[model samples]
Target: MNDVKPRPAGLRAVPSAVWALGFVSLLMDVSSEIIHALLPIYLVSGLGASMLTVGLIEGIAEATASITKVFSGALSDWMGKRKWLAVLGYGLAACTKPIFPLAGSVGWLVAARFIDRIGKGIRGAPRDALIADVTPPHLRGASFGLRQSLDTVGAFLGPALAVALMWLTVDNFRAVFWVAVIPAFLAVAVLVFAVAEPARAEPTRKARWPLSVAELKRLGPAYWQIVAIGFVFSLARFSEAFLILRAQAVGLTPMLVPLVLVLMNAAYALSAYPAGALSDRFDRLTVLKTGFALLVAADLVLAFTNGIEGVIAGVALWGLHMGFTQGLLAALVADAAPTELRGTAFGMFNLLTGVALLVASVLAGDLWERIGSRGTFLAGAALTVVALAALAATKAAGPGDGGSAEAASTKEP
Candidate 1:
């Protein structure tokens, strides 16, 4: 008889800290999505920006966050601390919330966006590392999945709220933006009050200059492999703003533009946990492969279909792919990196991938401008094929590969 019985299944098994952090993410996402859902149209129609400029801005904002993550993550390692850094990051972001409603020009909006992302950069790695710190190895996938699912819930909820507010305000973007600020602050409050850092068994040892070559070398080849694959995946995916632009191109009204994200996020939120839990049980790489294939399917759908219904189908697929891929990648990083260097590993991974996203978004904008939305999405499909090929080639290289889930866990959970 097996006297040890089993741990609680699903969410009950995850630590309280992970749940609190997920709520923090959910609140912040709700705040951010409300603004983001409307921002592309606001920049184009209200502030007189062009498609290339929109792409440039979005790319730069994300890149800034990724770049900042490197320093912030390294700092967290050097200090042997995670929670306070996360708190500071969330606070900074919350402070930037009001600026969106107050901005009168593109420059103001850009400045606000840049600062806001810096805050995200500051928090992103530390928070992720914290999740790894608290979660048991056996439950890593489920923990990440639950957090992602909750965060995505806010992702859709925010846009749904934005659509409702848009109807009520008669399409006042500023009013909707003002409303977004509340959740940003609430997210900060939750992080500060509800989440607590886990106690380590050993005394905290600081990594001297965590960004140094020696320190990076400690992250090992497995981590680097994940980073490379992540970069390729980013190139194939690009920014979500393009989805809104595509909807608009196909005659979606400004008032209903946010519905695009609402639909996409609904798919993402629904699938993220199930996909993650499934990965924990089966092979993660295989699930990720299916996700890559889904992206390919999504891009092809968007490329060929001219009707709104087709665009809707493509966007939903896009969301589903996100669900299957994003959290799994994070869990892989936690699986690959040294516990002490998890922050730097996540930061470096994000840095490379964020650069790829910049390149992809700018290229997508240029293609859309020159050849239309169809050409842009067709190009995306082509890139996804290349990424999928790269992934398959890696798997073909044999067992003990950097991304092999089986390699990481030799025993049953």
Candidate 2:
């Protein structure tokens, strides 16, 4: 027998639905990153806030999304519909964009950020579930990778655009924010008209009481294991604001700070598709471990080094870690959950991770305040070690699981 194996189908073979979703994500990220790349500086430099305030705001905003995802994911499962909820989420986010440019006080910014994150919460789980639904199992990794890559393209573009616009407007932050609104609405429009819900999995049970104990129990041990892995992983990751702060600390000007995100996201976009495709063919857990190693390496580099070269290398490593793990985690949830419970599973996982992230960011800020920047990253490195240990012995990292192309559509039966 010939030992050579054929490669799987390429991006052209991916569904139109997946591509549409990717664009939706791409547009929304473009809108979100443009603001996010500048939001921390705006809050601190312009609004006279502190790093702790930035961390608190970021944590709370993200935690709110995690809280809402629990309900939104359940709701999507109950309705057996993902697209409409995602549309509503995107629409809600679009409506919040104008507020960023108009806010005069911290309270206004906080309110807008809260609502915007709520929109993210609403769509996050359902959207992930929808991707799993539409694509065959064999293509789930590639599908997710493509979506992440597109989303990351937007991520980089938003910051790169912000850099250009900030210079044009003479560092007019509000103008850049106003421009961000256009892409957000475009995201909503694409989602509304272009994306369609796939057929629901066969009705295995009555739709009532999706959150009931019986239904919750159906989420399975494997899914919970993945959730645990995600939670610990969150502890290792914090707000991107710290990356910008690190860049600024090393003497990068405000107008050029967005370039940090541009660099980070560029690495992310370039790596995500290849990583996702690799996960589809290789052991996802092994790939996840590799991502963990990269994250640890990033933290160590940032912790021990200084200046532009260090920041660039560290941020690029951070992006690489994201490309390696994020989609794999999504695919893990898809593979582990029962088809009917995917939305719920993703929501629950995010909820845990969200809470962990909040705590981690707050801790990071505190560490930065009391000790120094090095302390913050060193702490992150410590947490990454813990997370790596958790994954090595846990149910999440099974032997050669979800490694083959045949495993893409292989949900928990």
Candidate 3:
């Protein structure tokens, strides 16, 4: 049977709420990426932190966010609302931007980063669930892709701005950070003023307890499978901070290091929407497999080549793999989870993957300190092969075979 109905064609078909959310993500990413692009260098050079310290800090910050997502996502479900939680999360993150410039030590920055990620955790699952709630299944892939694409636009733009600003200010990191604050508040304003949660149908029931055994069992085997794949995938991909560090190690001056993120995210922004749209017409797993292979290639390039050109090529491949996989993975989670549990599903997925990332980042840092960048990336490549094997094993159970039946009942207009 045809699971999706014929709908309006192209981006026009996507709901306005999705666009509003995308812009919110775009603005926030702009604010965050500015600090992020410069943060590793700042930690290592400015604060005199070690590579392992950076890794631990990045890993812990993300793990904190992922852990927080479970609660915030569940709270959204319990309240039967998503918009306000998202707003609060964005507001909190916006508030934290000023702290970056003022931070006097690694400890202060760590606190700010931890709090910022808590805000990220709070918003991520609910915002994603909101997207799934508003968009039709037929357009789900495109809608997620659009948001990813727009968010990535800010990702590159922030670094590009950082590059220019650094030059103009003679490498004034704090000045660039101060400029980053504007877009963050703009993100909050847009979320508050432009986006409205669509009305739920009658008989809307609050989830009794989103994390209980019964509720989790309701998420089903397919959802669990996706989670497993996500965990492994995250293992293969460590924090992007490593990418910035890699560029710096290869003789890219401090002022120009942000260019690395600029290049990578440019490719990511360019590819995300097309990749999502492609997944809509074909097997998402196939597209994801191609992405996984690209990561392997990227890792090899980064590991073997020691020049700036090699770093550039590796970064581009990394971004391409991100574009191919991230949104599709999100869409798959939406496909596999029950409608009422979408937030919880996203939360759980992120939590596991976030933990994996923590492990990967720590291991990468250890390797980088011991055997150098080559060892770190070569390890990543090996892990990607393992993740690919897991993905291959998952192919036997398609996205349709999961919780789609239950989810479809709620999705039908």
Candidate 4:
């Protein structure tokens, strides 16, 4: 048997593309977080929209992203291109940010969200594929984790900036949105000037519009099982709007919600890279399972908590859960996929999770309306438990256990 060797530390130096992508993400997230942190309040207090409307908007946005992810990933693979698609996607989203400040009603806000999500859909899979293409397998987890950590640093900083801006403007949300334009444009500029698509090994066969299942199945059952587990986990998870609302319910003022977001993102940014490195050393699946458990605990905590202190603790837990899950899942997907089909694998993973979030948000909204916020929290906790059980059962089934051929295909090339 051939021994799989790890790359030398010097050979694992960060690529220019990684740094460029990280900059683009930082800028984009700064733009996104500024608007997103305040959107629920803008819609609710300013526009008098219902919780259901908030859920609907979130569901639609996620569904739009989900539907487009598969096609975009497959197209990028067929075309053997990544940078142009990424550029277009980021450009579209950047242009859409200004519309939020301009909008006078919920209808326009929804439209802005739709357009923004369309851009997200267009870029996500291709961008992930680009990351995979530029990095080698052994280093893939750490590379992706570094990107996530940097991206989330923006998430932390953006909301902190927004919090300061809100205080400066005396809670004028529109002004914050306007200020967001700067980072959005900067993100686009960075992507255009700094990022490059790496060359792909050409397929021997002719390119087709849609890839076949046979092609996709090469990713293995462990990959699909992980995706399935992600979907279940997503079903319990709703939009961050609910988190903001929960904070509000627990006595946090509207302006202070961004601060809470900053805290969560700080935790996420701090944990992501370390979690990724640990997964690289251990089994990625075990790390992911632990993340799911943390999420379950967060939901349960949120269900019963009412005090500001409790809410803070819950959000912190939620942050820890995000830290553990996000990059780890990406690593798991990379581990399960062939280099050629990695783009499609990511798209499929996102697609499933997106759909799950759409449904979950809608369900959460309805539950919140009917049974109150506590009910929604309980439902999320329950669903997480179910997802955990399924994951355990799948694991118990042994190698080929979860239908992922890639589980047993961990041999390095």
Candidate 5:
């Protein structure tokens, strides 16, 4: 048998494309966050939208992003291009931001969100694939962590900026939406000018359009197991919108909500890279399992607590969970995929997660409506426990272990 060598670490040498992508993420997040924080208010207060409408809008937006991820990723693979697709996706999202200021009705707002999510769907998979392409295997976790950290930093800053702008404008949601356009434009400009796509190796003559299921099946059982876990994990995790609603229920003032969001993002930013680097050294699944355990604890805490203190603690735990899992999940996807089909792999992984979130959020919304907020949270906690149990059972099984990391590491990518 030929000895398989572990890949060397090359992520310490940050590339120009990574920095550009980070800046793009920072700007884009700033734009998106500013709009996202105030959107519900705009719908409910300004347009008199019902809770159902708000739920539908959000669910649709997320579903759109999820559904398109795989197709877009696969399209990028088919075309052997990543940058232009990323540009298109970012551009689409940037263009849609301005429409929010123009929206006079709930319908218009929904349309704008749909358009923006479509852009997200288009650009997301390719952008991730590009990140995988530039980063070496050994540094993959840290690379993704750094990207996620910067992304979360932008997430932190965006709402803070929105809060400041809202205060300045005396709560003029439209003006805040208008201000978001500037950053959106800047993000697109950075992608177009600063980021360069790496040259790809020549594809075999056998490469075909619309990748085959057999090609996808070539991804071993371990990768599929991770995807299954991701889906379950996502089911337990509902939208952050619910968290904001919970904050409101607990008497947190609207302005204060953004600050709490900043805190959560700060925790995410702090933990993302370190946790990711740890995953590089240790088992990714083990790291992800820790995150799942933390989430269960967070859900239980949130379910029982009644004050801002509890909300803060819960949010912080949520951030910690996000930090540990998000980048590590991406690294696992990258690790499990064949390099040539990485875009496709990431797309499918995201699609499954997206579908999972859609179902989870709907279930959460229904649970909230029927059983109350406490019920919704308790349900999430139960699901998290179930996922953890699944992980434990998988771990106890052993090498031939079906989807063992050793097996995952030996795969194409």
Candidate 6:
């Protein structure tokens, strides 16, 4: 611990490329969240879709992206390039932006969502890998946090913009979607021109076959532990669409519903960087435990309370958990996996979590239909208890054990 510097450098001390990547994420999130904030309402109220249908759509879209990430991440490692694949992903997402406004039917929305998520799938692993590639190992948590915080800044901004646009356009969903297309393309432009990929410490040209059993085996048990944790955490946390529904059930207006997201993301953006920096200085697992504790609190609050204020409190806690854990987990992945296979490791992690999310969302939707909103949240709290136990057990097993990434990290302050 004495080997490292005591004080952390400011954001300006990080590489310019990391800043550029953060902005790229920020703009794209601004575009995506603007559409996403209102999508459930649009499908249910405007298109007469069921809550189960909304759950299934959200689940399927994310699963598709998660599944696609494995291939893209592996391909980046195999091809010895991350930027081109990332550019392709952002461009594909930009192309799909116009489809949101043009859609008149459920099928159209589904297809457009599928395509847009494909773009996310393509870019996600590579972009994450690029962040790892560009930053110093010690600063990875902070780098990932900075990028996530910036992305969340867009997350809040997008919903806030949607609220404003809905008021101005008199509830025109299509127009807001139309406006979303601009920033997505702008994100692509910045990535292509502004960010520079750092030279890899090790050459990847020798390994063209990234999916071989030998290649897969190269990712040790430590990496797999991270994947398992991600899946369990994902199960306890389902689609945010349900949060919006809960708010509406509490009598929040259609336009004002987005404020829930704005508030949640505001908490997320505010805490992410500090949490990431904290992980770099402290035991990462201890920080993650705090996140798990917050989720449990959030679910219990949402389950027991019927008021909008309770929902507000729950959503804020949910965002704080997200802020505290997401970037730290990304840093853990970078720490455990071999540098050459970093992209593949992230893809696998996202893949398991993505599948878990689909299951969780579908189950939440079913539970909502069978019981009530309270039942749904209560179920979440129950699952969260299970996850918390698993996390504690993992922590007990020690850092060098398969379950803990602590052995892999460098927390020297």
Which residue pairs overlap in candidate 6's backbone? none
Task: Give one digit per residue, the lDDT tens place, for model 3 in 1-413.
Answer: 87996657588888999999999999999999999999999999999999999999999999989999988888887787999999999999999999999999999999999999999999999999999888777677788899999999999999998989999999998999999999999999999999998897653334579898878877778779889988998998999999999998999999899999999999898888888888777888888898899999999999998899999999999999999989989888887777788899899999999999999999999999999999999999999999898888785223334345454434323
In terms of lDDT, the best-performing candidate is 3
RMSD of candidate 3 to the truth, in angstroms, is: 2.9
Question: What tens digits encode model 4's per-residue C-alpha lDDT throughout 33-136?
Answer: 99989998888999999999999998989889877888788888777788888898999999999999999989999999999999989899899889877866
Q: Candidate 5, residues 75-184: lDDT per residue as tens digits?
A: 98788899999999999999999899998888888899999999999989999989888876667778888889989999889889988998899888889899999999
Candidate 5 lDDT trough over 10 residues, lowest sum: 395-404
* Model 2 stretches with alpha carbons more than 4 Å out: 1-8, 396-413
Per-model TM against the reference: 0.94, 0.94, 0.95, 0.92, 0.91, 0.93
Model 5 clashing residue pairs (backbone):
222-403
lDDT of 4 at 54: 92
Task: State the lDDT of candidate 6 residue by residue for 35-93, as single tens digits.
Answer: 99999999999999999999899999999999999999999988878999999999999
Is candidate 4 or 5 superior in lDDT? Answer: 4
lDDT by residue (tens digit), candidate 1, 1-413:
77997756587888999899999999999999999999999999999999998999899899889998988888887787999999999999999999999999999999999999999999999989898888766677788888999999999999999999999999999999999999999999999889888886463334668898877877766677778888888988888999999999899999898999999999998988888888777777788889899999999999888889999999999999999999988888887876677789889998888889889889989998999888888888888888777777653211113234323322212
Regions of candidate 3 where Cα sits further than 4 Å from its true position: 1-5, 203-206, 396-403, 407-413
Looking at model 3, which ten-residue stretch has the lowest summed lDDT? 396-405
Runs of candidate 4 exceeding 4 Å displacement: 1-6, 9-12, 204-207, 395-413
Displacement of the residue 293 alpha carbon in candidate 1, Å: 0.7
In angstroms, the error of model 2 at 52 is 0.4
Q: For model 3, what is the C-alpha lDDT against the true structure?
A: 0.89
User: Which 10-residue window of candidate 1 scores lowest in summed lDDT?
Assistant: 396-405
The lDDT for every candidate, in the order shown, is: 0.86, 0.87, 0.89, 0.82, 0.81, 0.85
